[model samples]
Target: MNYRQEVEALQPQLIEDIKALCAINSVYDANTVAENRPFGKGCRKALDAMLALGRADGFVTHDVDGYAGDIEIGDGEEGICILGHLDVVPVQAENWQSPPFVPEIREGKLYGRGTSDDKGPLLAAYHAAKLFYRKHPDCRKKIRVIFGCNEERGSSCVRYYFEKMPACRMGFTPDAEFPVIYGEKGTCSIVVRGNYRGGKLLALHGGTVANVVPQQCSAELLGEPAEYEESLNKFLTAHPEIRAELKGQQTHTCLVMYGQAAHASTPHLGVNAVAAMAAYLEKVCPGPISALIHRKLTDYTGAQLGIQAEGQLGALTMNLGIAKYDGCKLELTLDLRIPHEVEADALAEAVRMQVAEYGAVLEYQAGRALILDRESKLIQVLDAAYREIEPEGGEPQAIGGGTYAKAATNCAAFGPAFPEEDTHIHDSNEYISLTSLEKATAIYYRAIEMLMAD
Candidate 1:
């Protein structure tokens, strides 16, 4: 059968596998972490589910101490690896129309936390591998589908897995947009902390992860409740997109504001709750903390911090993701996506100097960038496969998002996410279009066939 026919035959099984994997609330939880399950019980459960599927499909599956697992097919000295992750970020149940973990199909879109971000794409690639092997059992190279449990927090799971095993000769990860991604910006995370003098600002909290823009923030301010309520009403009137609520008594008032969430790589699409709350507090809480927020944290880019740069990989983007002030102490986490042309340490020092001006301590952690030659054999093959299916598709491009391509050798992000569709990755109501999933499966099958062909 042709590639499309094969994918059509496997669509039901693929959808079932994707749904089964998406049903697990695989967010990393340290509280349930154990010997083999380093990430948590939920993540361990997700890993086992994938391996179980592989075993039932008559493929050799191995779980690398719960940190990662792989399903292997074929036999040869050289191998091809397709890396993906099963762990998802924490979700606000109230924000989603449907339960985040319960996979649902509506209007031809599969809605769930992992459906668009990863689980859907992972299964698509797996089914492609299965189809290729079934048609060509004597293919010369082995195919390995590697799944990790800690990609959301960090790639420690894959790091440990790679250290234990040898690198594949060639591979691609279906975690980003299609055509193909040849360059990915460097990632830097900064934690800013300082003493907070309790005044109008008694307590503040916002955000869940550093890579996602915070959609909600709450603050307790020292002020007359009625006056604060009036001010909040005015703020809401001016900015209808942000919803605010006021509570508490006469002397102290609590405020909550809701904004839109998006991935840090594309912060312009999000309305950061941390920034919005800080903007409001700048007027009521006149202090160093508020000053820092107004001066450097409000913008999506690092222009105010004097660290912004633009290059082939794109402009440096920043997300003021998490913020908290507990009456006397304050902490803010910043996620920055840096272009390949910029120096990460130099940028970090500049950010450190900027935050230091406000008496805040800065700690930086950097993830190295990945850049592959567009003319390389791997890129050529993947690009050809995509163009074969999508005749008018654009050429391979750069991205700000980091993927397992950096963790694996000779790899780049090839996709299940189409340029025309918004997958809402790392955001609320995340879903994958069924058409995109099918096309991606066929592309993966074609790419694998071309790569393995002599």
Candidate 2:
């Protein structure tokens, strides 16, 4: 029952795979991906690389069209799927204490883009699965360590994988917060587009991805430079979270504001540069963009805009993540994580109402809330494993972050990030403590054992 010894034993080797995956910087992209790239090329290679490692480690592995791949350990009628992702978020390296792509360890913490997000934890699970393969190769069930190339973008990898393979009898994904997770907020991505009748703003750009709170925003202006410079400075000053810089004279002015970036599900935990820019624009322009944001963009939770929709998980969260304006054409993308009970159209209506002032147009919509059976055998098994680790009764909760579990039934997100530790995933200087990664691997090993053993 004591798995800590096993987890600790794998520490040295698990660090190697975590470092390998982190060094790759397989950020989501089409160029880095090939024709089979449902998500992108870097991800595809990352997927293949992990599967190759699995095969090298003496597991039966398969790569499914560069979308997703699986490594099978043991033989059986039913399987336990340890799901995780090989892809990572695009890192903003300028502020990092260490070069992002180059993995570094300091004070027992591994630092890199994917260190805590998934790669580090995924490797832990990978190593854990290997232990089971060696210990009980003839077990009644199998352990398929599943990883995807596109968990960050569209999860077509998992979707495609499930279509090609079989669902797990029960499983866990180490891709989110932990002790345990009982529910996950619903998730939605919407693109709201509109045309402004040639405003003073030339081009405005902000945000790295729809799932992240924009840490920076930049805008070009066609106004009397003196008129707004003072106001802009005041705006930036009032919001210390946002760093604003001005370039060019008033005629063709450009302003850049830097904020802190974190996952959109917890926007209040981080600052959104787009919000600061919108605040200033609301003062200067009072047009659609400003009004739309004013009405919609609340700090973090979806309290404002009357979108305080809540369900079994928690309050719905909406992030006005990306924004841009090219010569009068304004485009914005929003990320929302709702409960399973919320319908896609209900979310759309809420968004449509918020942006009605902008005369916002819908460009695209994707993802509905996905829910797994909380009382199912998979959850019970995973919960028992988590309980075995933490006997003091810290309940298994839910979250807004999406994970590989969504791709299949009877799967839940498990983890390396303990409830007490914060490794700064998706932010600058992303790191995972050596202690945490080791602990996660052991937990994964035990969880796999209970489900895969006859």
Highest lDDT, which number? 1
Predicted candidate 1 versus true structure: per-residue lDDT over 1-454, tens digit per residue: 7779989889998999999999999998989999999999999999999999999989888889999999987777656889999999889888999999999999999999999789899999999998998999777788999999998887899999998877878999999989899999999999999986856888989999999999999988887678776667777787788988888888888898999999989999989887888777776567787789888888877889887788888899999989988988889999999987888889888988888899888888999889999999999999999999998999999999999999999999999888777888888999999988999999999998888774
Model 1 misplacement above 4 A: none
Relative to the true structure, candidate 2 reaches a TM of 0.93
Quality of model 2 by C-alpha lDDT? 0.78
Candidate whose TM-score is highest: 1
Model 1 RMSD to the real structure? 1.2
Regions of candidate 2 where Cα sits further than 4 Å from its true position: 1-3, 137-140, 223-229, 363-366
What C-alpha lDDT, on a 0 to 100 scale, does residue 13 get in candidate 2? 80
- Model 2: residue 177 alpha-carbon error in angstroms: 1.9
Model 2, 1-454: lDDT tens per residue? 2457766776888888878878886897766555777667677667778988987877788888888888887776657778888888887788699999899999989999898988888888878877776676566676778888888886877898899988777778889976667677767788888887666767889987888888788988776567677888888677776787777874788888888888888876778888878788878877666667765774466676666677888877878788987876778888888788878777678767767765876744656555666677667777787777666646777888877777777678877678767687878889998877776676777788877653
Superposition error at 2 for model 1 (Å): 1.6
Q: Clashing residue pairs in candidate 1, if any?
A: none
